[model samples]
Target chain A: MSLHAGQHPSTTAAPDATTGTRDWLIASAAAIVALIALYAVFFDNGSLIAATGSYLHEFAHDGRHLFGAPCH
Target chain B: MSIPVLPLLGRGLTAGGAAGLTAGLFSLLLAEPLMDRAIRLEEARSHEHADSGAAAVQHHEELFSRSTQHFGLVVTSLVFGLALGVLFAIGYALVHRRDPEAAPWPRALLFSGAAFLAVSLLPALRYPANPPGVGDGATVAERQGLWLAAVVIGVLGMVLVWQVYVRLAGRSAPVRQLAAAGTAVAVLAVLFALPGNPDEVPVAATLLWDFRVLSIASHALLWAVFGVVFGALGLRALGRTAAPAPSGAVPAG
Candidate 1:
C-alpha cells in the first residue's frame, strides 16, 4: 500500500490536535512578541488601556497608509 | 537611540514582543511543514524529468505563506509577550504584597521593554518623524522614490547574501527570514521621518500609535532575535535532514 491513502488523505489521529496545540503555543508566543513591540512603542504611556486604545485607532484606521502603499 | 531600559532586565519589551521573539525564534526552532511538503512535491515532479514551473512556483507560494505566517507569528508574539510580562509582575506583586521582600522583578519589564524599544528606535531614530507618504513630509513623491530606491538597494544587497545562506540551508527554510534583519535599521529611520511633521498627522496610521518613548528597544531586539534564531535553526535543520534516496530506488505509482 502507498504511504498516502486515496485522494481523501489517510488521516492520522491525535497528532493533528497536538500540532494544532503546538500552533497555538506558537501563536501564544507570537502574541507575547507583539506585546513586547507594543511596550517598546508605548513605554512612556505605561497605561496599557490608553496605549491599546490608541493602537486600535491606528490599526483600524491608518496602518497601511502609514506603513507603506498597499502591495496592490 | 537606545531605549532607556527593559531588555536589560525583562524578558522582552511587550507581551507581543516576547511572543514575536518567541515566534521568530521558534519559527527558527521548528521545522516548516509547509516548506517540507513543497520540497517533496518538487522532488516528485522533477523526478519525472519534467519542467513544471507551475509546481515550482506553487511550492514557492507555499514557502511564502510559511514565511509570512512566520512573520505574523513574530508580530503577534511580540504583542502577547509584553502583556504577559506586565500581567505576571502585577499579579506576582499583588499576591506577595504582604511580603515586600518579594517585589517580583521590577527590572524585568524595563530591560525587556528597553531592548524592544532599542530595536525599533535605533533603526528609525535618525529618520524624520514625517516623511514620504505623509502630507507636507520632507520627501515629495519623486524624492521618496529616491530614498525608497536607496533602501531597496541596501536591502536587496543583504537579501542576496541571505539567499546564499538559505540555499546552503535545507529547502524547508522560510522566506522573509532575511527581510526582518535586513530592513531593520533602515525601516526605523524611515518610520521616524514619517511622523514628526504635523502635516504627517495621518502618518499615525502607519505606526503602532501607542507612541510611547520605549518602542525603540522592542523593534531592535525583535530583529536581533530574528537574525540569531534564523541562523541557528537554518543550520540545525540542514544538519539533521537525510539526503533523499537516489533516483530509481523507489518506483512511482
Candidate 2:
C-alpha cells in the first residue's frame, strides 16, 4: 500500500493542500468529540445532566476509577 | 515519496486495535480482581457504619448481577482499547509526517512512550485513582477538576518538551539531552507546585494501598504492551512496502 513514509511519488512535491486540510479537519473533529466524551466521563457526573440524577456518574463509575478520575 | 495517508492511518488503527485488545484482556485478568476486592472491603465498612445507628444510604442500585458486571467490564475494556488505538494511529501519522526517515518500530516506541507519560503516568502521579468509597461525594466536582487540570498540564508539558527537543536536534547529543532534562524538570516542578486534592477515605490503609497499586500497575502494563506491540506492527508495515519513486525514475528491477 506504500504506507511507509517517503514511499509515495509525491514525497518530493510539496504537501498537497487539499489532503492536509482534510486530515486536519478530521483530526480536529475527532479530538473535539473525544474531549466532550472525556468531559462526560471525568467531570459531568450529575451536574451537567442533573435530570439523570447520578446515572452518568454510575455509568462512568468504574471508568472514572480506572482512569484515575477521583470519585467518592 | 510521501506515504499514502489513508493506508498509513489504517494500518496504525489496526495495530492499535490489536494492542488494545491484548491490554484489555490483561486488565480483565489482573486488575479486575483487585478492584473487586476493594469494592468488597468498602461494602463491609459501609455496613458497619450503618449499623452504628447512622442512616443507611444505598448509593445506587446494581444494574446487573456480579457476573454481568464482570462481563460488562470486559466489554468496556475492549471498547476503550479500540478508541485508544485509533488515537494512537492518528498520533503516529503526525509524528511520521515530521520525521519521514525515522525507522517505524523505534519511532512508534518513542511516540507511544511519550504518550503514556503525557497522557497517563504524569497525570496519575498528581491525581491517583481511588477505589470505591474513597474521597467525599460532595467534592466530586472539585476532584474531577483537579484531575483534568493535571492531564491538560501534562499534555502541554510534553508538547513543550518535544518542541525543545526539536529545536536542539542539530546540537550535540549531550546538549540535547541536557536541554530536554531541564525542560522536563521545569514541567515537573510546575505540576507538583499546583495545589493538591487530598481525599478522606473510610477504608483500611492496606485495602486502599492495594487498590492504588493495582490501579497504577494495570495502566502501566497496558501502556507497555501498547508500545511494544504497535512498534512491532508498524515495523512490519514499513518493511512490507517500498516508498514510491519520483516520476521518470527507472524501476530498480
Candidate 3:
C-alpha cells in the first residue's frame, strides 16, 4: 500500500509506549557515546587518555587546532 | 499530519555526510598541501633556532605518515559533517515546530547560514586558525579557555538575536529592518569586546596569511555545501509526507 493511502491510520494510531521507551533508551545511549567521543576529540588533553599516552592527542591534532582548541 | 522528526534527522545525517565528503575533498586538494608546506617551513625555522642556541622543540613520534594524515583528514571531515548535520536537523525541527505553513528549503538554508555564523565565524573572529607549530606550547590551556569562552558567548549572543528577530518578525518591514540592524550591531559589539588572541608562531607573514585564508575557505565550503545539500534532502523528505489541504475546504469545527 502507498504511504499516502496509509497515512490516516498511521497518524491516528497511538504510538506504542514500549517502542517509545526503547527508542529513547537507544537515543540516550548513542548520545552518551557521542559525548564521550566529543570529549576525546575536543578536550581530552592528557588526564582522560592518560593510559593511551597522547595517541588520542596526536590523532585529533589538526582538528583540535582547527577548532581553535589549544594544542602546542 | 505533522512532520515526523526522526526521518528528517536521518535525511539530514545522510546529506551532511555527503556534503562532508565534498568539503573534505576540497580541503585535501587545496588546503592540506598548503598546511603541509607550512609545517615544513615551521620545522626548518625550528631547526635554525636550535642552531642559534635556542632549545629545540620536542618532536613527537609520527603516528601516521603524511599520506595517512591526508586520508585521515577526509574521515575526520565526514564524521564532523555527520554530527553537524544531525544537530542542524534538530534545530530546524524545533524552529518550525509551531509553524505549519513553513517551507523546507529556505528554512534549512537560513538555519544553516545562522549555524555557520554561530559555530565557525563567531569564534574564529577572536582566534583565527593557525597552522601547526604556530602557537606557544605553554599557553595552550589559556588559549583553549579563551576560545571556548568566545564560542559560548557567540552562540548565546546568536540565540538572543534569533529571539529578537522572531519577536520582530510580525512587525512592519521598517521595524523588522531596524531590529535586524540592532541585532547585528549588538552581536558585533559583543564580538569586538572579546579579546583577540595574538599569534605566537614564528612563521612568515605570507605563510600565515595563506593558511588562515585556506582554512576559512574550507569551512565556508563545508557550510555552503551542507546548507544546499541538506536543504534539498529536507525538502524532499518533508514534501513527501506533507498532504495538501483540500481545495475550498470548510473548517471542521
- Give the best candidate by DockQ: 3
> Per-residue CA lDDT of candidate 1, range B25-115, in tens?
5433332332234345445654554464343322122223335543443444454445544433332223233331111133233333333
Model 1 chain A: weakest 10-residue lDDT segment is A63-72
Candidate 1: residue B136 lDDT (0-100): 32
The interface root-mean-square deviations, each candidate in sequence, come to 17.5, 3.8, 3.6
lDDT, each prediction: 0.35, 0.66, 0.68
DockQ of each: 0.03, 0.32, 0.34
Q: What share of the reference contacts survives in each candidate? A: 0.03, 0.27, 0.25
Superposed model 3: Cα runs more than 4 Å off: A1-33, B1-3, B59-61, B99-102, B242-253
Order by TM-score, highest first: 3, 2, 1
Q: In model 1, where do residues sit more than 4 Å from their true spots?
A: A1-72, B1-147, B156-213, B242-253
Indicate whether candidate 1 or candidate 3 has the larger lDDT. 3
Better of 1 and 3 by TM-score: 3
Q: Which model is ahead, 1 or 2, in terms of lDDT?
A: 2
- Write one digit per residue (lDDT tens) for candidate 3, span B31-129: 777768877887888798899999988554577677876776677677667777766665665566554224556766777788888878878877788
lDDT (C-alpha) at residue B227 in model 2: 73
Docking class of 3: acceptable
The Cα error of candidate 2 at residue B123, in Å, is: 1.3
Q: Model 2 misses residue B65 by how many Å?
A: 3.2
